[model samples]
Target: MIDVRDLTKVFATPHGDWLKAVDRVSFTVAPGEVFGLLGPNGAGKTTTLRMLLGLIRPTSGSATVAGFAAERDPAEVKRRVGLVSANTGVYPWLTARETLAYFADLYAVPPALARQRIAEFADAFGLGDFLDRRCGVLSTGQKQRLNLARALIHAPTALLLDEPTLGLDILGRRIVEEFLELVQARQLAVVLCTHHLEEAERLCHRFGLLNRGRIVRQGALEQLRAETGLHSLHAMFLDLVGARRQLPVTSLKSAAPPAPLT
Candidate 1:
C-alpha cells in the first residue's frame, strides 16, 4: 500500500551548499506488511516520512500511499494513512476523549461512530483511567498512549509510526505491539521508524537501513544475514556501516526481499 522510488530531499545549508537529507531511496510495503525504516539520528528516516505525509515536497522521485501520489493526492493519501510519532502533539486543554473526538470530526466521521471508536480504542490501550484527564497533566507514557489513540481515530488503512513506542513502559509497548499485530491481521500496512533493533526485529517483516541520506541496505533479516554473512541483526547493522566505508558512496542492492511474514 506504500511505494517510494528515487525519493530524494535536498536542503540548503547556511553556507549555501546542498544537503541531501534523503537520496534516491526506493521501497514498497504491501498491505499487511510492517517495514522497518532503521537508522541512527540524522539518518533522514523522519525526512522520508514527512515527504510521504506531504508535509514536505521531495526534491525528486515519487511516493504513493494506497495508490494516491503523496504530492498530488495528499488529502486522499492522508485519509488512508495514520501517523504516530514521538514528536506528536496533543491539545493541552483538551481531555483525552475530547482530543480523539476532535480528530475524528476532522476526518469527517459521524459523532456517534466517533464515540464508539474512541471507547474501543480507550479499552484497547487501557486509557479508561485517564480518559477524562486534561492532556497537559498526563504523564509521558499516558500522553504517548493518547497519541496512539488519536492516530487510530479515523481507522486509516496504513500507519506511519516514528518511534511510537519511545516513551511507553513495558505494558505500553506490549499494547502497541498487540495493536500492530491486530492491524496487520486486517491487512493494514505499517512503516515503523525506530532505533530499537529488538523492537524492529520483533515487529518488522522487512527493513530499510538508512545512513547519511541513503538506504544503504534493505530486506528481511535472513536475507540480510545471507548477503552480509552476519548471523545477528546487530552484527548486520555494524557490517552495513562498515561496508559503506569500504565502498564508494553509492546504492548497494545486496539484500533481496523476503516472502511476507506470516
Candidate 2:
C-alpha cells in the first residue's frame, strides 16, 4: 500500500524566491489498485514521486509505503516499491534472461528463487523467445517487457510508472497495456503518472487530477466525468483547470495537511 498526506515541495530560485513545485498533495493507493496522477507539464507529478522515493526532502507532509515512512526509512520504502519509467534502459550487453537475474541479485533474491521468477515472468510477459538474446538486439517491445519484468524480479509491493508508454509505437504501447493487467493481478499498488488520459481511463481504478501544483480534483473516471459533465479525462481536465480562475491559488499555511491513513 502507498499513503501520502499533505506532501509539498518548495524550491529556492536563484533570485531568492521560492517556487512551490507541489502543494499540499495527499492521496492513497491500496494494494492491487492503480491510481493515475494526471497533469500537464509542471503539475508536480514528478516532484511528488521523487518525494515518495525520498530522493528529495518535502517542504511538509509525509509519504509511506507498506508502513515505512519514506522520509524516515528511505531504504525500506525503496525495497517495497519499484519504479519503471519511459527512460528505463536495459544494459545493452546483458541478455534478456541475464537482465532479470541481475536485478534479482541486486535485491538479494535467492539464486534459486530468482531463476524461478525469471522463468515465470518470461512466460507471463512472452519473453521466452528472446530470453537468451542480448538486450541491444531486442526490439523495443521486447526490451520494455524485460524492463517491466526486471523491475518486479524482487517482488515489490508497489510500483511507480512514469510515462511507461511514451515514445512507443502502436505495438509497443499494446505490449505495455497487456503488461499493466499482469501488474494488477500481482496485487501491487501502482501509481501511474502519464499524459495519456485515454490510457489512464482504461487502466487506472482511480485518479488524482493535478494542475499548477495543486490537485484540482480527484476520483474515479466515472466520478470525474460526472463531476465535470465531461466524457473524457482530457475534457474533464481542461474543464477543471479552467475553473481555477475563480478558485484562486493560495498558500496552505493555515490548512492542515492530510492525515496518514490509520
Candidate 3:
C-alpha cells in the first residue's frame, strides 16, 4: 500500500522566485489495485510521483510506501517498487540479457536466481529472439518490452509507470496492455501516469484528475461519469480543463502606440 498526505514540492528559481510544482496533493493506493494519476503535461503528476519515490524531497507533507516512510527509508521503498518509463534508462551498449542481469545484481539477487529470473522473463516477454542483441539495435516496441521485463526482474510489490506507451504503435500499445493485465493478475499495486484517457479507463480501478498543480477531481470511472454528467473520460477531461478556444492570434493587437521617437 501507498499513502500520500498533503504532499507538496516547491522549486526555487534563479531569479528568487518560488514555483509550486505540486500543491498539497493527497491520495491513498491500496495493495493489488491499479490507481492512475491522470493529467496533462505540467500538471504536477511527475512531481508527485517523484516525491512518492523519494527522488526529490518534498517541501511539505509525507509519503509512505509499503509502510516505510519515503523520506527516511527511501531504500526500503525502492526495494518494494518497480519503475518503468518511456525512457527505460537501459544502457544502449548492453545486450538485453546483460541489462536485466545488471539490475538484478543491483537488487542483490543471487547470481543463480537472477539467471533463472532473466530466462523466465525473457521467454514471457518474447525477448528470446533479441535477448543477446544490444539495446541500441532493438526497435522501439522491443525496447519497451525489455523495459517492462527489467522492471519486473525483482518481482516488486508496486509498479510505477510513466507514459509507458509514449512512442508505440497500435501493436506495441497492445503488447503493453497485455503485460499490464498480467501484472494486475499478480495483484500488484500499480500507479500509472499517462495522458491517454482511454488507456487509464481501461487499466485503472480508480483515477485522480490533476490540473495546475492540484487534484481537481478523482474517483472511479462510473463515479466520475455520474458526477460530471459526462459519458467518456475524454469529455470529462475537456470539461474539466475547459475546451480549447479557436480564436485567432492576430485579434490580440493593442491600440496603444509609442508616444515619442528617440
RMSD of each: 11.6, 12.8, 5.2
Per-residue error (Å), model 3, residue 161: 0.4
Candidate achieving higher TM-score, 1 or 3: 3
Q: What TM-score, computed on C-alpha atoms, does each candidate reach? A: 0.90, 0.89, 0.91
- The number of the candidate with the highest TM-score is 3
Q: Cα lDDT of model 2 overall? A: 0.89
- Tell me how far the alpha carbon of residue 27 in candidate 3 is from the true structure, in angstroms, after superposition: 1.2
Candidate 2 local lDDT, 204-228, one digit each (tens): 9999999888998889888987887
Question: After aligning candidate 2 to the native by TM-score, how far in Å is the CA of 48 from where it should be?
Answer: 0.7
Report the lDDT of model 2 for residue 226: 84
Looking at model 2, report the run of 10 residues with the lowest lDDT sum: 240-249
Q: For each candidate, how many residue pairs have backbone atoms clashing (under 3 Å)?
A: 0, 0, 0
Candidate 1 residues lying further than 4 Å off, grouped into runs, are: 243-262
Candidate 1, number of clashes:
0
Candidate 3 lDDT over 170-204, as tens digits, reads 98898889888888888788899987889888989
The Cα RMSD of model 3 versus the native structure comes to: 5.2
Whole-model lDDT per candidate: 0.89, 0.89, 0.88
Report how far off residue 100 is in candidate 3 (Å).
0.6
